[model samples]
Target chain A: MDRSKLHSVIALDMVEFEFNGTPHKSPPQTTVAGLLESLGIEYRFCAVEVNEEILPKAQYSIYEVKPGDRIEVVTLVGGG
Target chain B: MSTNIHRLSVAGKLLESRVIVGTGKYETLDVMRESLDASGTSCVTVAVRREKLYDRDGKNLLDYIDLKRYTLLPNTAGCFNAKDAVRVARMGREILSDLGNPGADWVKLEVLGDTKTLLPDPVATLEACQRLVEDGFKVLCYTSDCPIMAVRLKSAGAASVMPAASPIGSGQGILNPNNLKIILEYLKSDDPDYPVIIDAGVGTASDVAEVFELGADGVLLNTAIAHARDPIMMASAVRNSAIAGRQAYLAGRIPKRLYAMASSPEEGVITSRPW
Candidate 1:
């Protein structure tokens, strides 16, 4: 596996967070959860939507992520 | 039933159907899809949460539904105050705008003050609704069974006021019909065009029908239909029940009676009990 090629810009919609830039040509078959785990960022109370498609938390293990994907991760916060 | 026809208009768009469904709690995507199709609902509500778009892997639930079919109503589902609701509403607008869906201004404003009952914080909800409306967002406020609050919401420019039949996911079914009826009557008297939807606490199709019969413009249900053994079938039943109830109301129901109706002929004098 080429570590240098695994760099590609990952975008986080949350203002408080940032995806350390895109992951390059790593494996195209990376799971969403695997990618997040690699980044050392664990989202406890959030839901992810890729390219306007909502990904259920349960399917993160099987779902694959690709380059040039606009990802949105929304977290729950307190307020009335 | 008055000969005058009733129409429900939200954000200047007229909807012939009055049943609104929530896209949550289905065991499977197929069941959800089938349920929505059966519900005949033009609008379906969704909640927004924070998560990474592209994680270590693949596609998400957002792709499951055909956005072209049903109207997407983003709700401030977990927000507990007006400020949070405003923030989420802004995020919702941005998400929609970025997606090239300008119609995202329509929001189901929900501000739960308590976690136990998931009750609507009427005061905060109204505040949020007022601000959203002022910001050009078409607000549909989920409130409690308070006529005064409902009236205030209507007056504050809410596109619609959804008074809860009971707490969220409680399946209580119009805990206070008298209060809801009063709210309906007030809306009719003040602004006959105001749309009043009974949101939450609806256990079954009959519950939905009862609300519609009580003169609500529509009903918003999620758990009842989604959690059913046969969600799709229940959705169909709820849809039909809502329509039937609305039609029954339009058809004018007989006034309630204080006593039982006499089964025998009063004047004909039938000699039946010759003991």
Candidate 2:
């Protein structure tokens, strides 16, 4: 019934999202690193951008994902 | 008899070979490796794009390439905007640094516009070139075969200004030698050794030779060899043709004239009615 309890309750009920243009759902206690790890995307060869701003690789461990975060993960592939 | 070894000097690095080969479009890693070996290229290009890697062996495209033997030139091939190109260049720099080649800092900028044509957007290319150069990154920018654009890119601190012979992957092969000649003249007039590499649309060995004959410092292509029926053999031909063309250019070609002129001296030639 309190404001802080209401905020926590709303956060617990969060879901759904976008990653590299595809719609994705967020599991409970998912960080950026956790999401990428679960998807089997290796971090060493790629860099991540959250909501248009590129985050440093070291921040991957602590950068928490929001419900509407537009994440873009890019890597180097065979191209001309 | 000029037996001097021609080196491709750009961004202050002296490369043993002037031909820069592309690392894409090959059937397999072994094929790519063999083709590269046959091409005699001291440098090879690699494009930056997102690829899914699920294997634990770290078997990647980069792994196939021996960085110690070849200079891996990372390119911003598909970027259509300046910002994206700059980001990709930075990521490439980071990736190479992480791979233990910390001094490998050159980037090939290709800000392509219109997917159908796949030509570079001049404005975006220039903008990316300037920004990347200012960022302390050596930029080899791919531009249209227009002297003005080539000049502008050189002024923007591009270590090498590349003009496409035709269009990327078109296999047109020196569609406009005059345009490339103009680009070379404009850039080299000021700095006679300014690096002007022909970037794309090369079809075969003769195409490579024609570009060299036109006085371009180097040529870069992917599909010409990778898509060939025999990639390694084609690569060998390309290498030989590049060398031959460069040598011919150095050897001094005969001048064109409206009327025929005897190569032999008239005095030395015996007349039909011998005196």
Winner by DockQ: 2
What lDDT is reached at residue B120 by model 2?
96
lDDT of 1 by residue, B37-125 (tens): 89888778877766444552333344555667666678899899998898777666655543444247888899988999898888898
CAPRI classification of candidate 2 = acceptable
lDDT digits (tens) for residues B56-79 of candidate 2: 455677678887888878899879
Q: Provide the lowest-lDDT 10-residue window in model 1 chain A.
A: A9-18
Give the 10-residue window scoring lowest on summed lDDT in candidate 2 chain A: A71-80
- Give me the displacement of residue A37 in model 2, in angstroms: 2.9
Question: What residue runs in model 2 are displaced by over 4 Å at the alpha carbon?
Answer: A1-17, A26-29, B1-4, B53-58, B102-104, B257-275
Q: What TM-score does model 1 score on chain A?
A: 0.55
Q: Give DockQ for candidates 1 onward, in order.
A: 0.11, 0.40
- Which numbered prediction scores highest in lDDT against the true structure? 2
